[model samples]
Target chain A: MKKVALLTAAIIICAVPFYGQHFITKNGHISFYSDGPLEKIEAHNKQVNSALNIETGDMVFKVLMKSFVFEKALMQEHFNENYVESDKFPNATFKGKVVNMSDITLTKDGTYEADVEGELTIHGISNKIEDKGTFIVSKEGIHGNSKFNILLADYDISIPGAVTGKIAEEIEITVDVKLKKFSK
Target chain B: MKNWIKVFVLAAVVGIGVLIYVWFFIYNKPHMNIEKATPDYIISASECYDHYANGNNNETLNYTGKVLQIYGSPSSIEKTDSLTVVVFTFSTGMFGDEGIRCTMLPSYSNEVSNSILSKEISIKGYCSGYNETDVILEQCSIIKN
Candidate 1:
């Protein structure tokens, strides 16, 4: 009985850090910029949901298509109605993992380069992506940031020939999120 | 020949005017004024969270992209240098507490004081959609009764 009790206590001690291994942020920020020949378009979505499991190097991000705010209401409308079809595909998601998770310690305070590979889905289509990101570990939280460019055609986001000059073929996406330790 | 020239000149002038109107008014229209917009749904925060938590896809669909006026006491109010976020927590999930997270407009940031904690208040914003854990609202403005 004493041996069983000792094993149970050891299990509890091992599981304590595991419980705090997950990090999450509901109010993450994601923005995309399009530099076209005729026009420059940019939109920002502040209410991004991102979760990261430091133990397993798993990460996921969910962004609402309708949450993207453009400076021009007409462009925003066109984006929802024509470009991305927000009604049909209301969310863009990424399910990926940090390839080099073993190099960084979460308890340590420093910025570490993160190599991420994942499936990014937009407009009901998914594509494999490999990119570099940074994880800044601070006393407050972990700040995750990445900048990458994605071709609209890769995700089946087609632009009409008439307004092709007003929208770029490749869009620059920036992700900035400060994640806090997730405790149940 | 003179009549044709006159007609062509008038058509060109009209075309230019149309292009100007399209460029200044239609193409560059201002964003939605959330302060003046009416709420499509008036609901409590808990009720809103329950709809998503129960996997009521149809019910959740009805609220997405629509303006909602939610009334509830915030579980936590996070004020930062950039924006203020008011969170209405429902239950603990795999990531964290799942609920409605309302990001107030920058102009209304000053109005969300710590004194309003646990006090019922109404906030109106555009419902972006559920991110599995929480229903996000942006361009939020506090509604004073």
Candidate 2:
């Protein structure tokens, strides 16, 4: 009990000083699309918590799996209760560092390329993912966008043979986040 | 006897078809109408945060997934392009702040035109699970007379 209290106190004390280097957004957007022969399906999640460190180029993203909203109510229900089992694994996250950190100055206003490699966890499965993203830093804030594709079977998401034709083998994921400097 | 059998069979088929239609179309509907739904718990924002932060196993289990009416003073108000968020942060995260991040429903946009930084308010929403950083709520509506 005492040790846990000490760690909590330590985290509180150290959290503020790191704010200067942290760029954050609570409303990061992520959408996934699957185009099959039968139907094209997609869902979007707008509430994502993400952080990027300008000083070190380390980045992290956290999103609630249940937050992914589908245009069709039936599709949303199937996604949570059937596919993802959101009650069992409520979140999907990515933790990684940008590859070429030294080439870009995040504080200065410019459009740059961000090459990041990270382990992305979805539906209780982790896979190493590498991608390039477009980033813009300006007076308003910073915007980052990345597009990638993944195979469903790789993540152990089983689609019964009955509905295999209805869903695609690979789904496309797009991430867009606007981060502002963290402050008190 | 033959005519009666056909009528019974026809009725049973139609009934099965109607049941499938309702299951696919109506029963599987998402819980979208949050304001009309009853909240499972009415708690202060601090109490809600504390449960996610340091509450016991069942205490934390008791709160997750239920609709909650949280009353608290706002610590920070943020108006992003896509979202109007009100935060009741208690813990400082790796980036300096963490608490309840409530994404308000669109109906309350006019009422909260700008920041309401310190006013005590009650908001109702579905309680999603908490990350180490913050407890999240969605589809929130301000409780007002």
Candidate 3:
């Protein structure tokens, strides 16, 4: 009887955190854009770094260095081998918190705009960033959409003179994330 | 008469040289565009394993998936043939309660140290589905960081 009680208590302890509202999806969409005179270059990595800790309202995201695919094979290779050196720095990640987790109940149908602040790491560099997005809480999962700007130089990405006009200094990024509440 | 023949020969030689240069340098150059050529079906490491476990064979244009971020050295599969494969393991879900471990077989060209094996990578390839313990992706190209 004592063992049964201990097991029950352990299960409850493990299940308590899951009772909160938090959902995750491995297949999330994260896209970025950089335009230049020669070409309008756009690349995206679906395998982004992502996690949502419901108990703490902390969300994290990651993307592999070598996963950002542009339109050209040579360009992709250069971006990995020469520019990003994916072998050296394998991933880009973001860790932040949802400002208003208690105010919104994600299980029911509702829309809430939350401010998220976190450290965005890319090209082996980490920077503190803040972004705002709309989060729609549904019975199925959580949907989030946000956009932000990043400077190529901020991450030490140097565009050669030959392709200088082809790439922009500042690029716009759009993220459409959908996370499912973790089943306890 | 001799001078005119020599002049004609010289002109012909230059023309042939120019033609050769155009053929080799202009036309025979690499036409593959890396940015455009990368397979877009970017899938997460765990999802890649799931597809392999289920034995799903579908070649899509691109995949949008997540990168597995676990701290550990990567392990390479002993090569049965000329092609050697590597494996990485991840939990069933990104952030789940129960940690159901799954393995991912990434077909890579270059080799890294065991210590640096967990180098996160996003690979785009033609999914040929599962092969025994490994998932097969053909003609994969590495995306930029």
> Largest lDDT belongs to which candidate?
1
- Return the clash pairs for model 1, or none: none
Candidate 1 achieves a global lDDT of 0.88
The true-versus-predicted C-alpha distance at residue A103 of model 3, in Å, is 3.3
Instruction: Give candidate 3's error at residue A33 in angstroms.
Output: 0.5
> What TM-score describes the B chain of model 3?
0.40
Return the TM-score for candidate 2, rounded to 2 decimals. 0.85
| Model 1 CA lDDT for position A61 | 93
Off by over 4 Å in 1: A1-20, B1-13
How does model 2 do on interface RMSD, in angstroms?
2.8
**lDDT score at residue B47, model 2, on the 0-100 scale:** 91
What is the DockQ for all candidates, taken in turn? 0.61, 0.35, 0.10
Order of the predicted models by DockQ, top scorer first: 1, 2, 3
Question: Model 2: per-residue lDDT, tens digit, B1-145?
Answer: 6999999999999999999989876856555688887889999999999887884557766776778899988887777776777889887866458899888887776667445668888999887777667888888899984
Report, to 2 decimal places, the DockQ of model 3: 0.10
